[model samples]
Target chain A: MGGEFEGVVRPRRMRRSRRGQALVEFAVVLPLFLFCLLGALDAGLWAVQTSAEVSAVEQAAMVASSAGSSPTSETAPDAHAVLTSISGRLRSALFGTTIKSWCTTNASGDCAPDATQRCPTTPAEVQDVDGPRVVVVCVSEADPPACATPPPGQVAPYPPGCEDSPMITVRVVGFVASFVPPGFGPGASGFELPANISATTHTLRFAP
Target chain B: MRRRRRRGDDAQAVLETALVIPILLFLVCNFIAVMVQVTVQEQLNSATALAAQSRFQAPENAIDPSGTRCCGAPGMSLATAGLPTGCRYAAETFYGTMTTYTGLLHWLRATLCTSGGDSGNAAIPPMQPVAYAGSPSNAEVSCDIGSIKPGGTVIPGYVDRALNPPAGLNVVTCSASASLDFADTPLAWGVFWTPTLHAQAEALPPPFRQ
Candidate 1:
């Protein structure tokens, strides 16, 4: 009876089998394997977003540069119109969603001495019939019209006719979406990714 | 007795998993950190290129003339009158002289003369220094005296300076800067272990013949 009891329970035989060892090893590695897989997925998503940002900026610059004949003179209205249209196009092509945009001329004093006077108006003499004009478009996250609108009652302070200078600066700003999972941890909170892009083009001369 | 022995064996798998999970998590996070840094660097490079190009093609007005002042936009022919001999706005006569006489005396005198000096002495004394100097003064003279003077040349003209860009075109120099933070992730902790990448780019304007 004791010999039959020993035969029925065979714990040593089960412990010595390779199948048990294999099971233990798999359990040990599964967490690590999952971590690696998820990490790769996260990385791939980040790469795709970054590529989209680059392509958008490149396309915008090319479009702005090629707008008209050589040395395109841009008026504030004209610049705003062009940038608004382009921003819409880029939003559709890149994100498949519409995004807010603002356009401004790089009328900063550092880049253009007469930027103040030249920034808002067509690069024409206050009264003269013919002159080259340059307009810079700045795009940002602000809403349209409101984004492009300057502060109220701000008269261009610089002398007139300075607007026709050849140097025009354009800037575009936008947010890049984050890839981190929401509510994961304090570290996984929303991340703000801002991109600023700028380009320059010569002003076109307008006929008298 | 057999049941008690089986319970101890069951805990082995749990203990092994606990020991290995943290290590695997660390490795995965490190990989992600590396990928994020690369993406940041690429973004920086693109931004710099765009900024530089914007600066390069920026309208001529954006450039600070520094000390130079813009006089009236008189017609091209008006630029030559009373200009120092050899001062050429569009006229051929002033070209050789303006190119050779680039000097302080020549510039000050040109400024005083072109603006029609407020006083006679203001005009006479400045010219005296240049008139007495023999054998081509070292001071740089303006080609178009009425259009620009030595004190006024500080404004950089779009077409004036020589900048060698790609394809044999000359361009103006503009600068750009950017800062970015890595996304918050368990992997971001690994960023401290890796190198951050930084880069810059320069662009030039279309070439013009002198």
Candidate 2:
């Protein structure tokens, strides 16, 4: 017990304790570090998944807006069938198979945006919080054109072609489960940033 | 000497960890901001394009009657002033499709409706050109919509008579600009900068209707 080096030179036991203290600190910090990492991963995945769904829905809407798919008359191409392929491709990319298709036509059998017959029970509801992504495909015109002669949005009060043109809307709800916890990172209410897409196309001709 | 050196090393370790944590947090925030920007930009492109194309749905010479407004979000209508029925449709479609991330955007307003969209601003035809006839007061996105009259001498929104050939073909265009302000989001604490995103689109009249 030489008091000369009391403070400057510590016992080997003290040095060992210091090393142990470092180990303890690392142990405490490791889980927190790992948690932050996982949170980052969750956020990144969410962002990328959101981007994917956006691309998918927009593409589907574009297809529906294009000509030949719109029913100027019942004789025109079937809208449902035309959009199914595209929707299916969208499913392959992000959404699931069975896209909830909706239609609204006037009682007169003319297409309109008010049809709600085929709309799902909760059109905006996310069925499962953790699996099987739910996607909704809403069309201003019925797939087969209730009467082709009257395009969507055309009904009694308004003239035929003067009515609003057909439009297609695609929505992705509860896409990809949220990996983050209840209070970690940034998460939208439904675990995903729901994308609402409505696109329509109109044709024009040149004059001589 | 050894004990003092060890204390200095521990202090250094603590400092490094403190710095690393904040940097990682920043990376996460920036990544989210960039992703949001991309998504919004893409949606804007689609919306503007759809708006241009929707203008053609109205009659060739159709014009919005006096005191007309427009379609907005469901249950909500926008007072787009009297313009063209097609213009209203364009506004409706544009507003409807660009639905996500509205709160995060600080729009850079331009004339809501353009003659040939933003492209019509430049003189590029066999005649005089006008960019915007009028626009909605609070319109965010801008569109270029013009009609092809039966006996019109020169097209208003024509791109290039020489390049497009023959006489002229009308083209519709649209553009929207906005700054995605991330200062209000949850991740904003770590984010420092707000980025500006701009999207534009154009469409030609579909065939058969010709």
Candidate 3:
């Protein structure tokens, strides 16, 4: 009976081999498990950061909208003051972030720095989807006046006053570094997220 | 010896599972909890902002269109007429908007099934009146609007009074708080508690006096 069983299975060697197999399985699963764990951690942090940024931008927009714009400077210039107030509201780590605001004829303007689209040359009558209008904040893809430094002779790109400013675009641009590797497991610290997170809000200059 | 070795191999598998399972569960459950926390926080932020903005659209409690009479003239003592009309309207608007926003948040809570630990099955409480740290007179939704001065006390009027200040500009602010209860989550067994989340926002009324 013993001889027949021995031929069928080598028990001692099988036991040791089985232990080796289990170790091999664990080793194989460990990296995949850790990769997923770390990835989730990274993504969760990113979502939180992005929401914070959007809220900050929205708050800034509300401030600007309430104050409305004016050619005449008040205690603080409306646009600058609004941006500064937003900066004050955001976390100190976001100090490098820039706030841009502008007015234009349509939503064809880029409100970010280094934009090239032209502001309306004159207060030409522009159609408003809701009402007749002369100006609208051109934050769509149009050049933001706050971002540009026009030549001395050229008209100021962002004209002042609520009527001169039919719409206001407030944009906040900043970077958020991940707490974990950008694309994969924990050790890929060399990766830096390529693009920044930005939030843009357009509010009618309702304060006239 | 062979039987003993086989038994040891079985024990090894059990031991490895025992060591790994709890750690894995901890990580997974915590991940879920954090995700829910972020979602709730984001919802709170949006609600707070919209509520603040709504305060501007409220009818200006004004006898005049310019809104000059809303508060007495500059440096004139506090208006004896009780809270300014714009202030009261802003408070009512802010509170109403908060209720609407909070109701909207129900969808989020349903999807996530998380709430402040104290709320249990109930919805988060509505916005409450909070005075600036030191100024008891300056209620969260009060006509005594102003900037924060040296201590936490809020100075009762706009410094830039140049814009003729909007009606809702009377220092009307909103704040809300709720806890993210991990007790109801899969992490309940592991995480005994969650920190409370809070949001506060300030806005001047819309500049349109009418």
Candidate 4:
């Protein structure tokens, strides 16, 4: 009887020990596994958000530049009021959307310049850095309605027969906040993700 | 005794499953998110190119009847004293192309972003125009021939002597920029900052021989 009891008790003890060992191993590996999984998830999420930010800015900039949407509305009526409405619309669509006007210097100094006036020869000659800078001009409507001379740093090559014409320009910019988790991602100590997510655009102003 | 050992094995299996399943889920979700992002970016690029191309399609005579001859409508023309027919209304073209864009994901494109997105048709940020080139300076005409018409010669009538635009004039080019945000994600707790992505596209107007 003693031998029989000993056999049963010994097996039970062995089983208990094996189960305990497995539990210990699982506990030890679980945290590390969890960390890696979460990290990957974070990276993926960051990428998705980045793409979304870009999409948002592009859409906003295009709409702002297009004629059908140029700041003037039945409700807003006037240019300033239309501009105000535009600002509100952009802000609502994006986290922080700002419109920077790039215009030739006007008599009052940053209001829309005389349409026929030429752009300054150099960027440094520009008096107000606050006003948005003109990257390129399209002569969609010059007296001859052609393309403007390319600016200092203009990239797209000008087309032919397109003379300098009356034209409007629009610029849009928006910011995307960083996604790094504090003390975890690239900006653990407050460093931001290296990629610049600010999007800027230049387009022909559709509004006359 | 045998049953006792089997019970111990079952306990171990349960723990392993609990640990491994979540990791697998995390990885799978991440992969899906990344793929979605890539697709979105590609669509944006196509939209920009299409929009630029459409700008050139505006009938050469298309003009805002109310536009002033000097700057707005009836673009200044050397052929005539005032705004001429067949002049392009660039703003309208740009807006039309962008609003009708159907490249984006169905969910993303809730409405055409018209009127700076303030018209309440849909809520979306506007697309910004970044750069454009049309007509060439006399210097550029000689310096950058290929850029203007590829293989075409400068037409005698294309030159605007009054404006005195340099040679090799006549091409429409446009550049557009945009931004997007990821509004929701599963990693919110583990992430502190939201990510913003930016993209830009440039295109030359459809080629036209002067």
Candidate 5:
């Protein structure tokens, strides 16, 4: 019965095999185009990331600069705070979380040279985006621009004026995933690693 | 009959592919051009931010000593002669960051240095910008720094930038908006649209410096 059914087999269904080379080429080329597309997309996202961090740091420094010389560690709110706040509810990270650094006074030299170490050592992610990223603040100023003893007998005025200038620096550090093959984005050779982007800014502090 | 029909199908396949390959290539070129534009936009944002932040760094009272700031990309150096030290710094930062792809870009021209547009800008019209007294004529990248020498009284900048939305934040800001064109490049054949990219940043003024 099986032989009888097989005996009636029709002509081979070889229409797909007719364009076997085209099918093979498509298979080879599809991945290449997709990879390039991803790289292009990543470039846009990278710009967004950088802009967000810069905005965050610039705003924080501006706010803190107004705090006067004796700034009491006012680290700008990260994305989580933004997500919860009234004004910030409308503003949230479009891609991933922003890991803002707790501002440090007179500690510029201690910042990690590596971008990866700058954020939380333990990687954090929201969806495909990495976390513990964004602004790092460093305040540089003469510890006390005013005299402690007030020249022994001189009457020290309230909120004494400082002759010294102060500077506040903010830095943005971001890690982005790079899937584009070699000679594409981030990687010098191989791919599949998080690309590090960082920029540093320093401005004279605003002391009211 | 079957053989003749197969030849016709092959010819049609070749014709379809011939029509498609150029379109695909043009699409890819546009993609790459867009990437470059994104990067340039990022640079513009950084430059503007630095310029705003730098305004604070410059002494509140100092005017442009050089009467001309030096050191930006060659063409972009936009004779910032007779502008504020702050404006000079801003120009340098802007031109400096825009070092790459200068030839490929067709920037939206603005007055190199401006002061006293407090009356209004194109955004909040009744638009009358205070004249840029000493800024070179060929300058692009217009910036308004409050006002200058109005009735012989010079004002450095406003506590609140008149150009900014009146939220009263009193923050120093840097922003840049410009269009990128690849007309001079071979890619121009494929990329037609010149995208305008923009970014603006703000920081609070220093208590003493302001």
Candidate 6:
């Protein structure tokens, strides 16, 4: 009976063997383990990207608010140069992507040309006018002051040959890539991860 | 006897696997849960800072650069060809008031939600108020922009708008609260405890400089 049982080769014994059991357990757990590990790595990358976006917006706001040495007319001057100069910083901070800029004199109404089009320019008369200036700076595919006619009797706050005035309205918008890899789940797709920050500050006054 | 021994061995192997699988899974899930929680917390912190900064940097429309009272019509004198051009100020009183009144709360909510964390969940508690140096009720005080320095100060009233006080001769106080649930796994005999984490931050306006 012992010889017959040995020759019969019970498959149950192999299943019970400790070495094979470890292999089976590993196979069962491996997919879940790998999923969690990859999820963590992706999440970490997302966090870093988020941090970078936050810092970029904050820095951009700071730069926009701080007064610069641009020559101005009687009306407030366009701070576009100062804004664009910081664009590179923001872009590099965001991993070397292109940064766009948009500026507008009107705030209540939609700035013409929208986010995708060039920023329309206030009429020459508006630029030459002495009034509050609204400057919208965003990252988009357009130029500022895109040659739009100003309302009758309203002049641009900053015109050529006007003395540089420091008062201006500055709006800044930044776009950063989403941290999720391409072709991820819904939560990760079609998100530009844009940051909109605005600040208004005048030239710093020194104590006499 | 041989057949009985083989059967016993198979039963032992099944028992061992049943025992090990749950523990291993528990460990893995716990690790994932902790990591997600940490990431959420970091995002929350970042949102808070951004929102606070946004509030501190009030919009131009919200402030009266000319130092006019809040009730007065909105407008600024323009600098024309070598002369000041008088222009009708658009009434942005609402804008100013909104910035002062809801700045902090707006920041708190926007920052929290913007980072992909849900505030409405039972697992997460709403932000709570913390007391700083001042009134004992300071723990839960909400001040308006009118109460602070007069409107149109050019500089917005609160340094960090997330802290509730819009403006004041006295200081403004703000509070925030949040909670998150930890992942759980079953044990041999019972279940492991789940954890809830919370955080809060406060800011005071710098004392008026001479």
Provide the clashing-pair count of each candidate structure. Answer: 32, 7, 10, 76, 9, 30
lDDT of 6 at A134: 21
User: How well does candidate 5 reproduce the true complex, by DockQ?
Assistant: 0.16
Residue range A174-193, candidate 6, lDDT tens digits: 43444445455354223333
Model 5 chain A lowest lDDT segment of ten? A118-127
Measured with C-alpha atoms, the lDDT of residue B185 in candidate 2 is 72
Tell how far residue B110 is off in model 1, in angstroms: 43
Q: Give the per-residue lDDT digits (tens) of candidate 2, residues A83-159.
A: 56456555554433245444443586444444454333232443442233455554444332233454576553234
Stretches of candidate 2 off by over 4 Å are A1-25, A28-36, A39-44, A66-83, A95-114, A117-124, A128-132, A140-162, A166-168, A178-208, B1-10, B61-77, B104-111, B116-140, B145-169
Off by over 4 Å in 3: A1-19, A63-208, B42-50, B53-152, B155-169, B181-195, B202-210
- Structural RMSD, model 4: 17.0
Worst 10 residues of 6 chain B by lDDT: B85-94
For this target, which candidate reaches the highest lDDT against the unseen true structure?
2
TM-score of every candidate: 0.42, 0.65, 0.44, 0.34, 0.52, 0.40
Please say which candidate is ahead in DockQ: 2 or 6. Answer: 2
lDDT by residue for model 3 (B1-210), tens: 777977897789779878877777677666756665675566456555554554344334331122222322223322222333333233333332222123212221200000111111113232222232322221222222343434545443332232233221334454555555555444686565565677776655443533
List where candidate 4 sits over 4 angstroms from the true fold. A1-25, A32-52, A63-180, A186-202, A205-208, B1-210
| Interface RMSD in angstroms for candidate 4 | 9.9
- In the order shown, the candidates' DockQ scores are 0.10, 0.28, 0.07, 0.02, 0.16, 0.09
Consecutive 10-residue window with the lowest summed lDDT within model 2 chain B:
B66-75
On TM-score, the stronger of 1 and 5 is 5
**RMSD to true structure for each model, in Å:** 18.6, 8.4, 15.6, 17.0, 11.2, 15.9
In model 4 chain B, which range of ten residues has the least summed lDDT? B137-146
Interface quality of candidate 4 as DockQ: 0.02
| Clash pairs (backbone) in predicted model 5 | A62-B204, A99-A133, A206-B206, A206-B207, A207-B207, A208-B207, B67-B82, B116-B146, B116-B147
Write one digit per residue (lDDT tens) for candidate 1, span B99-131: 211220112212111111112112221111121
lDDT of 4 by residue, A134-172 (tens): 122111112323466767775323333354322232222
Interface residue Cα RMSD of candidate 3 after superposition: 9.1
Highest TM-score against the true fold, candidate: 2
The lDDT of model 6 is 0.34
